[model samples]
Target chain A: MDIRTLCLGILALGDATGYEIKKMVAEGSFSFFSEASYGSIYPALTKLTTEGLIECRQESQSNRPDKKIYSLTEAGRAALEDSLAKDPRPDKNRSEFLASLLFAEAVAPERINSLVQDRITSHKRQIDALKLMRAEEDSPVGQFVLDYGIQVQQAAYDFLIANKGRIVTKL
Target chain B: MDIRTLCLGILALGDATGYEIKKMVAEGSFSFFSEASYGSIYPALTKLTTEGLIECRQESQSNRPDKKIYSLTEAGRAALEDSLAKDPRPDKNRSEFLASLLFAEAVAPERINSLVQDRITSHKRQIDALKLMRAEEDSPVGQFVLDYGIQVQQAAYDFLIANKGRIVTKL
Candidate 1:
């Protein structure tokens, strides 16, 4: 998704500093489905403010840079709703582990097993995190997103566990 | 993974035109996990050739643009192996559908169902494609990747079919 739309959505939740916006975009509830670096987030926020979809004010802070707080305008809320109503853009998922495994024959057999093992360990952590998040989410939308993450990750972990033997020993 | 390493891996498969390389990268094995656009691929190929990792030979076609076929050199093979042996980068996956669904309350009740139904139908097509691909893949690495795609898509399809109504009705 465009960082502009995402910034509007975040500000709609509540007022936030640019730092908070970047943090939430990277690691919050919607992190799995959306992402933006500070480079992108600051520019997006600036543009949204210029377009009047959002408004920001400055706050003085001790021993730190001044915080710029942002909130969604009424127009921003409508824009977000309109965006959600439209057809979503196609997904673009990146998995370097899968890419490496595709070239498994070139590596030592143990390394293939190692990679799969590492994936399972990391993925399990994600599934557990999602499970906890799902438990706390009362909104159907939040639940739906959490369930999606859980299902996909669980499937990956299951596949690796069930099939690793077949591939690992053969190489 | 970086496009340069990915181009090396694609060339390791066999000699392929830049057009063919992009197709395979976007649609072939590991596609769901790794991606590169023609914008990145051409540069990657050029740089690989310059670095002595890949060699390209021009093929004159009768009525089409002259094709450049890329092949992996011994150094390229070693580089790919070395890459595989290293820890894979963390995955960054985007699901625009899931992102849209996260705002289900903001959208009309019926549109939520519509979005989910579209997602389920499209996801099933991917599951079917992966199944067909898996059946033909004899290599262990190829089979692993296909199975990964199938398992995840299948899990998603199942979840949507079973739980979508509960979420849809409440929205």
Candidate 2:
């Protein structure tokens, strides 16, 4: 989702700062199907507030910098609903690793092995994160999404392990 | 992968016209991870040819317009190998639908149902495509990648089918 739409959707639940929204995507339940860095989230907030789809208020602090809290306006909710009612964006699982492997014969065997090793390492890390999310999630939908990630990543890891021997033998 | 990189990689396989390159991405084996439109492909080819990483020849035809066939140069092969040796870009499965569902509490139940229905339909179609590809693939790695796509897509379809009732019940 575009960061603006995602911000509106997040605010539909409760108010939060831009940091909260970014964190929510990076490590929260929302990480399942969406992604946005602080770079994109901050700009989206500015745009959303300027467009009046979202409104922001400052929570004053005695010591630290004031926190900017944001929430979706009525128009924002409608906009988000309209988006949801329309067709969902197609899923894109663009993996450069897989693309590289598609021409493994052209690559040095050692380089291919290193690529496979790095992929396994990162995918394992992903599976670990999903397991943590699954442990904390109570909702069925959350569980389902996390489980889906786990299954896919695990299958990839398994496939790599099973095939690594043959793939490396050509080196 | 960037269009330039993908174009380079595609040419590394064999020589082809720009039209053939587009067809390869759309219906050929490369459809799984990378994507390139004619808009991007033509530009990439031009740039690659200018850099001497690839060469193109004009082939005359009796009834058809002359076609430009592209082939990777020796320098292009080295460049492609260099790219493959580096880290592959991370996978991105951006789905606005799942983001919307994360706040399913905010949408009309019927709208949610329709969204889920569309998701299932597309995923099933994706599975069909993968099955067709799987039938023709002989490489173990190719089979693994296709099976991974099929399994992940099937799991998603199954989850939507199994859970759609509760999500729609809120309408």
Candidate 3:
């Protein structure tokens, strides 16, 4: 999703600063499905505010810049619902590591072996995060989503482990 | 992968017109892993030619605009290999549907159900495409890549099918 729509949806749940929105995406259940950098998030918030879909309150903080807390307006809630009703773009799993593996013959045997191990390790980490998030959530949908991520990541790790020998030998 | 590097890689494989390059990406094994639009391709080709990384020749057609057939130079091959040697960026999957699903309670019942069905159908189609691609190739690496796509996509489809009813009822 575009950062603008994502910010609006997050605000619909509760008010948050721009930093909080980025933090939520990076560390929350949303991390696997969606992500936005500060560069994208800050600009999206400014545009959403100008469009009047969200309202912001500047709160002073000790030893820090004033935090801009943004909340969804009624229009923002409506917008979020409307966007949800539309057909979403297909999910992308654009793994550079997987793509690089296609050219494994070009790399050294040791390099390819290390790359395969790294991918399996990373998948394991994501699976662990998904489990933790699933534990913390009550929403049936959230649980369902986490379950999907866990299964897919685990499947990938298994495939890597099972096939690593041939791939390494060929490399 | 960025469009510029993708274009470079395709040229490294063989000389091809811009239209041919687009067709390759649309229907080739690369479809599963990367994509680029004409908006990015044409400009990239123009820049590459100016930088001496590629050479383009205009071939006039019967009724269409002249086609530019681009070929990679020695410099281009070196550039591509250099890019391959660098640590590639991590893969990123951006899904609007999953993000919206996290807020299923906000959307209409019919919309949620239809969206789930649509997403499931899309992933199934991708899995089918990957299967067809697998049958056309005999290399172990190609087979592995295609199977990887299938494993991940099927997992996604199963998750949606299993959870459809819960999302529909809550919507």
Candidate 4:
């Protein structure tokens, strides 16, 4: 998804700073499905403001950079709706773990082991976080997306644990 | 997964024309994980050739554009391995379906219903394709990634089928 469209959707929920937008993407159940870095988010916000799809207001902060609170304009809301109406691009799974495993023969056994262990740990944490967010969901969309995250993460964790030895031994 | 790294990985398999490379990406198991347009692939191939990471040989063809088949060099292989050693970016799922469902209230009831049905149908097809690919897998990495795809796609399909009514009716 375009970052501009994503920013509009998040702002529709209420006002937020770029940091808050990044935070929401990182910690929210939505994070399971998507993420945005400040690298992309700040530039997206600037572009959206230029295109007049969103409005921002400055707020002074103590001992920190001033926050730019962003909100969706009517145009932004309409654009988001239009984006929704269009066909969604297929979901992609570009795991570095998978890519590395394709060349496992060249990697040190310990390195493959560490990578597998890291993936298991990460998957477990994501599953836990998704479960936690799911506990509070009142929206169908939230519930559905959260459940999707839990299912995929659990499957991944199980695969990692079950196959770790195969990969590690081969390295 | 940067496109440049992805291209290097493909070349690791064998030599192929840029057009052939695009076909491999679109038709192979990698289809679910990544994509590139001819626009990007041609330019990337030229740059890689100039940088000495890859070597290309031109082959004359009948009634078609001459093909430039690219093969990875020792340096290219080293670069690819280096990229693999680095932390791979997590998989991203930018689902406009979920985004649209978030605003189910604004969409027409029929439109929401149609979208849900279309998504479920499309997911089912993808799951079937993943299963077929799984049947043809020969390596551990292929087996692992195929399993991952099947599990994720099945979970998504099940969720959409089970929750379509709850979401669409809210429109």
Candidate 5:
């Protein structure tokens, strides 16, 4: 989905500043399946505000710039609901690791070992983070998505460990 | 990796027309982890040829227009090797399915069931296709990557089937 639709969905939960929206996407539950940077989020928020799907109010700060708190309008809620009703595009697993592995013959065995080892470590870290998130998530849907992430990452981690020797030794 | 690098990698396998390169990405072994469209591939091919990374020759077809076959140059092989030596970016799992499920409360229970069911079917199909590819693959690295794809897809498929009720019933 587009960042605008995602922003509307985030606001549907509660009012948030653009910074809060970016944080929610980058470091929160949505981090696993979606992405939005400040560059894209601010533009999306602005457009959503202009289109009347969302409204922004400036909260004054004593020592800092005013915080623009954004909340969903009735139209925004409708739009989010409408988006959920439509069929989502299929998942895309864009793994540069896997693509690089496709050319494994070109690299040294040491390079292959290091790459797989790094991936194993990365997956472990992600699984741990998801577990932490799982403890804090009370919603069934939230827990379900977390479990999905953990399961898939675990499978990949296990596969890499089990199969690393196959590629490394062959090189 | 960029499409230009990918194109070079494909030609590393053998000389192929742009159509063949597109097919290899869309339907061949690379389908699961990479993507390229004609719109992007053609420009990359043009740029690569100009840069002396690849060379293309036009062969007249019997009934259709002349077909351009591209092959990697010495520089292209060197470039592909250079890319392999660098660290790959981490994988990105952009799943609209999971993202939609995150806001499951906004949609109907039936919609949730149908979405999950469709995902299950897609994963099953992917697993079957990957298995077929695995049989045809002779290289250990090729088999390794295919196995990774199948295992992960199986994990996702199983997860959705087992957890569909959790989200649907709550909604």
Candidate 6:
């Protein structure tokens, strides 16, 4: 989905500033399945406001500049529901690590070993982060997604540990 | 990695026509971890040719247009090796299915069930396809990657089957 549709969905959860929306995309629930940069988030918020799907209000702070907080309008809620009702496009997983592994024959055994080790470490970090999120999640839907993430990452970690020897030894 | 670098790596495996390279990206080993469109692949091939990293040779075919085949040059091989030696970016998984699940409360229970069911079917299909590829693969590295894909898809499929009730019942 485009960042605009996701922005509406985020606002549906609660009113948020553009920075807060970016944070959600980066580190919150959306981080598991979606991504948005500040560049895209700000523009999407602006367009949504212009379309009257969302309303933006200026909120003053004592030490910081005024922030633009966005709330979903009725139109925005309807739009989000419409988008969610449609068939979502299939998942796209682009892994540069896997792409690098495709050239295992070209690299040294040391390199291959290190790559596999690094990937295992990364997956461990993700699983740990998801576990923290799972503990904090109260919504049943939210907990389900977090558990799914953990399961998938754990599977990957197990597979790597099991198969690392096969690739490295062959090199 | 960019399409140009991946093009070099694909050519390093064997000489292929632009069409063949595109096919590999769409359906072959690269399909699991990378993606490139005709629009992007053609331009990447042209740029690589200009850079002298790869060479294009036109083959005349009867009753059809002459096809351009691509092969890695010495420089191209070196370039591929250099790219492989560098660290790759982390995996990026953009799953619309999971994103839709984030708003499970916004949709009907039947819709959520169908979405989960559809995702399970997709993952099953991917696992079957990967298994077919796995059987045909002779290289250890190729098999390793295929197994990785299968294991991951199976994990996702299993997760959905086990958790569908949790979300649907909550709605």
User: Could you say which candidate leads in TM-score?
Assistant: 6
**Docking category for candidate 5?**
medium
Clashing pairs in 3: none
What candidate 2 keeps of the native contacts, as a fraction, is: 0.52
Model 1 vs. true fold: TM: 0.92
Query: What order do you get sorting by DockQ, best first?
Result: 6, 5, 1, 3, 2, 4
Local accuracy of candidate 2 as per-residue lDDT tens digits, B1-171: 778778887776668899998997887667767677899888889999999999989999999989999998999888888888678877877777777666665545456566677888998998899999999988765676677667777767776677677555564
A52: Cα error in model 1, Å: 0.8
Every candidate's lDDT? 0.80, 0.78, 0.78, 0.76, 0.85, 0.86
How does candidate 2 score on lDDT?
A: 0.78
Between candidates 1 and 4, the DockQ winner: 1
TM-score of each: 0.92, 0.88, 0.87, 0.82, 0.94, 0.95
Better of 3 and 4 by DockQ: 3
lDDT (Cα, 0-100) at A22 in candidate 4: 96
Candidate 1 lDDT, B1-171, residue by residue in tens = 888887777676668888887888677766677777899888878888999998888989999989888888988888888888789977887877876766545534556878988998889888877888788888878887888888988998998998887767663
Q: Write the per-residue lDDT of candidate 3 for residues A27-94, one digit (tens) a residue.
A: 89888878888999999999999999999999999999999999989888888887887778776666
Give, for candidate 2 chain B, the lowest lDDT window spanning 10 residues: B103-112
User: How high is the DockQ of candidate 1?
Assistant: 0.69
TM-score of 3: 0.87
Worst window of 10 by summed lDDT in candidate 6 chain A = A102-111
What would the TM-score be for candidate 4 when compared with the true structure?
A: 0.82
lDDT of 5 at A58: 97
**Alpha-carbon DockQ of candidate 3:** 0.55
Q: Write the per-residue lDDT of candidate 4 for residues A1-171, one digit (tens) a residue.
A: 777777887887678999998998887766766688999999999999999999999999899899899988888888877777787776666666666555443433346676777778888887888899999987766687677668767877876677666656553
Q: Of the pair 5 and 6, which is ahead by DockQ? A: 6
Chain A TM-score by candidate, in order: 0.86, 0.85, 0.88, 0.80, 0.93, 0.93
Residue B44's lDDT in candidate 1: 79
Residue B70: error of model 6 in Å? 1.1
Model 1 RMSD, rounded to 1 decimal: 2.2
Candidate 3, residue A168: lDDT: 72
Clash-forming residue pairs, model 6? none
Per-residue lDDT of B89 in model 2:
76
